[model samples]
Target: MSFLRRLTQAFAPPPRAGLDRHLAMAVLLLEIAAADFSRSEEELGLIRKQLLTGLQLDASSAEALLSRALDRSDAAISMHEFVALLNEELDAAGKRELLSWLWQVALADGRLAPHEEGRIRQLADLLFIPHADFVQTRLAAGA
Candidate 1:
């Protein structure tokens, strides 16, 4: 590598490496939270908890990631790009598990709004999650 190029790379922010998947998952969750046009504290809390637990991230890291993910979700034109990334990165079981977590977020507000339910269903289809498994996850989430 050229010395100047190497120096530039060294001075640049370190790559997040493997965090893209985490951020994509976070974006999906955030998308669901915002789907109803009202984001509840309950849902936000659940999203933070999931980011920390599911991604094994420290609190600060999770917060930072979530903040970035919110921006990405806001700028997103469609969920297809994020869902495509997930499909490439995760196995069937992993995808199913993510769908379950999404359901948990959807149910966090005590009652599921129609828009929330529809968003979940749409995401489930995008992720290639079967309807049976989607229902099973919804039930498991106590929705």
Candidate 2:
């Protein structure tokens, strides 16, 4: 019974809440991960790893955050909401770091899809990150 309950809880949707900066970033990452019209295991795994490492979340918290990110991603009409939250919350260095994470996700499959590049470009512009930073992150991510 205990194991079953834990398993059930693991699959359950986390409570909906206002989007925090971290969650906003996750939504954007998910968007980038799916930009190529397919969500490869590689992209998905990188996302989880980023959330765990970047956000310093425990496994369960990362899972819950990913759950919420998926719901937000599915229901989103545009990336504006997430972008706006990040714009308000992140500094220049923070934006650069976020872009690096996005680049990492975009390159997870060992290639950069055109759509993924487009999405990342749009996000960088929206985040007010300079072109140099964008290019630098892309290059650093192994292109």
Tens-digit lDDT track for model 2 on 81-118?
78888998999999999999999999999999999999
lDDT of 1 by residue, 1-143 (tens): 99999999989854444447988999999988888897899999999999899889999999999899988888878777788889889998999889988888888898888998999999999888899999999999898
* Model 2: residue 58 alpha-carbon error in angstroms: 0.3
Off by over 4 Å in 1: 1-19
Q: Rate the local accuracy (lDDT) of all candidates.
A: 0.88, 0.92
Residue clash pairs of candidate 2:
none
Segments of candidate 2 deviating more than 4 angstroms: 1-17
Q: Please give each candidate's TM-score.
A: 0.85, 0.87
RMSD of 1: 6.5
